[model samples]
Target: MLFFTVFELVAALPYSYSEDLARTVAQLGALAHCSPEVISAWSCPLCKKLPLTNPQPFGLPDFNLSGYTGTMGTRLFLLFRGTEPESVINWIEDLTFEMVAYPHCEGCRVHAGFFASFKALRGQYFDRVQQAVSAGKEVVVGGRSMGAALAVFAVLDLARTFPEHVRVSYNMGCPRLGNQQFADWASKQLQIYRLVHWNDIVPHLPPRTLNYRHISREVFYDEPMANFSLCNDSG
Candidate 1:
């Protein structure tokens, strides 16, 4: 078992939000949910010309992740798929509320199920990400739902190694993955754009009463394709 002691909070610099970038990232995240064939054939206007390579699907029989690693100009990207509607395992992972010690950081704990899913694909994803960093490219990670949680974990782990290269993470409908200690530690390590779409219940899950908390800089959209507000971390 792992345990942690309180660490002083370090104020993170505010991240500059760009709607265009967010839309592009969101497209990549959605593309992650597609089948391998679809992903290969994908011809979206936003990323059609970008050279996306190293496409692979990873996970166990019970848990799976569909994503790809690619680069556009100077930016390297790792995008992950969200929960599949018919995946019982995915829902099971989502509902498993137990908190386990996150060994990578002292006093950091994360949702057990989310961590499990992440572990299944961590090695493969890390290897590719490491290669990209070695090639001197800035990294951007993004995902939706459970994939978002996994992205958060990847960002933290990546930050441990290539702190300068692990640029930022863009997550949509992300649930709170860890306790305050983890959130505090993560906030200072990297810039995270947690996008919450108008009262989406997933972001509110495993409830704060259970000691789960979110990281800083939440981007909240109140209406469909309407204006968005940058929320304070307190929520």
Candidate 2:
């Protein structure tokens, strides 16, 4: 949509998320749309000069294939994206998959307001997914680092907004982003998968929150190689 060409989309990304990271993420999104695969819909924002409680944060998920079609409907695996220098750019692409084609259900768009949620508009974004699943579509959710944390938030949102649509969520390298009480409450309601790379440091930055079931790992040897990291290669 907004970024028409592959090059255009890659160029629009922050320098921290590298072309490699963006490319890989794009591939991941594409692959996820396949039969029984996981798809991602990232919508994160970063605000340097805004208040922490600002109603509209400005981090984008940088997703691809917002207009996925299988003659079967749409299946998704959403990733929130973290703050690594390399993969941040990729996250941006995931968010803006296709300005014109970005997923929408009624008035319930991807960006469901920070203070406000489309919990009331459950079918707007997830109805199609449920239909697909009903017809038998395999969907999965995930994210890396902060993306993983955001994935957690998304599922909780979906549970509250559209409890019947979601079945499972697997987040990666997530480091707790919600309140302890809320986190515990959400964890009890859904099937969440949290994946972490080997000794991921970015996740530790904002300080992990309390609550929610978790899974961590230390598998990588260095950074930048993880370009699709939250930083988005500009770093």
Candidate 3:
């Protein structure tokens, strides 16, 4: 497989790559638990840009790892929910800080509790992604905040099974998901784009003091103007 460092990839981003789509996807991920009727009514470039319709717009009913999914054009989206009140409680209650090397991958260590929750919920959406891929469709996975953290885990696992099928991932205001080694490894394997807001304090959590590190290729924006600046490996 080929790998581009964060700097190289960002430099090559096309003008047509649509930051608007990225923001919309992030919003969808943040609202994963919202009702289907609301989700359907909310217009986004996913359908307008791609000219596809959602045959099935389903969201995970379980509160713990609730996520939303839908079909748009030849792309399948798997979006995870962010830190709601219950998720915050989970973060506080499960404060063991245990780190284990991710299975089937070398030199990658992740938060045990987060990884466990992601693994449990992943199977629920993985099938749909696989089905879409098998039918020659692209798969885009993303999330915001805590859901962004979970989405990273999902992409790491999914890449092993559907390398070519798994396309870009949009992580909005995501917390650090793993250690330096894991970040480096995941960056090389996936086209992961992290979006961070200047005033958004959530991305700074789990602390690097805990040995957590973010992946490469960040699109940062702030304040009055949401114009984005691309960064590499570092926020």
Candidate 4:
């Protein structure tokens, strides 16, 4: 069940698949590539649960060769979400290293975000992803909602550095990050993808101003709630 495979089954999918749509496709691609579903059904690939905590710095346990398609390439993935797991010290440190200790430039402010300095932190993560790519590893990133934002950033960052390495990227219910400049810039920079389900708006509070910059590309599950959010839900 390649993403296109599932996508075709669902809908023709209007555009060429950008940003959040790319991520959604990747998730399904992984599922399809991993195995042929005897029949279509709703299930969790991570049904066992990774049991990870916020900023805990733990790799997905069963991600490696748990029956995925591929001829065996070294796999390197980075998944770190924001503080929802109750234990988020590791995330704090990673950010501290990138923002506080790094160069004083390159950090964009969405508001309180400027309270910290996030220099080449963006490039650093890009480098990490690049390293995996250089080693001939298939790199994939995932995060809940807040983590999804970072996952999106990771794609943008990697696109800047590795270019070809970032074949696909995914984020689930991610919040808007950076600014209009950042999003507009990134929309063109990377093959970033996002996935939002109906009104499970964990990736909430975008368009800080009362004036909403309609996100026509944001991928929401084709459902009543999603339709409502896209319609009368009106920014």
Highest lDDT: give the candidate number.
1
Error of 2 at 215 (Å): 9.5
The TM-scores of all predictions, comma-separated, are 0.84, 0.41, 0.80, 0.51
The C-alpha RMSD in Å for every predicted model, in order, reads 7.5, 15.9, 5.8, 10.2
The lDDT ranking, best first, is 1, 3, 4, 2
lDDT per residue for candidate 4 within 200-221, as digits (tens), equals 5444544446221222245566
Clashes of 4: 7
lDDT of candidate 1 vs native? Answer: 0.75
Candidate 1 Cα errors over 4 Å, as ranges: 1-15, 43-62, 85-94
| Lowest lDDT 10-residue stretch of candidate 1 | 1-10
TM-score ranking from best to worst? 1, 3, 4, 2
Q: How well does candidate 3 score on lDDT at residue 66?
A: 73
Cα lDDT listed for each candidate: 0.75, 0.36, 0.70, 0.40
Best model per TM-score: 1
Query: Residue 70 lDDT in model 3?
Result: 75
**Model 2 poorest 10 in a row by lDDT:** 48-57
| Candidate 2 wrongly placed segments (more than 4 Å) | 1-76, 79-127, 133-138, 161-165, 208-235
2 against 4, candidate with superior TM-score: 4
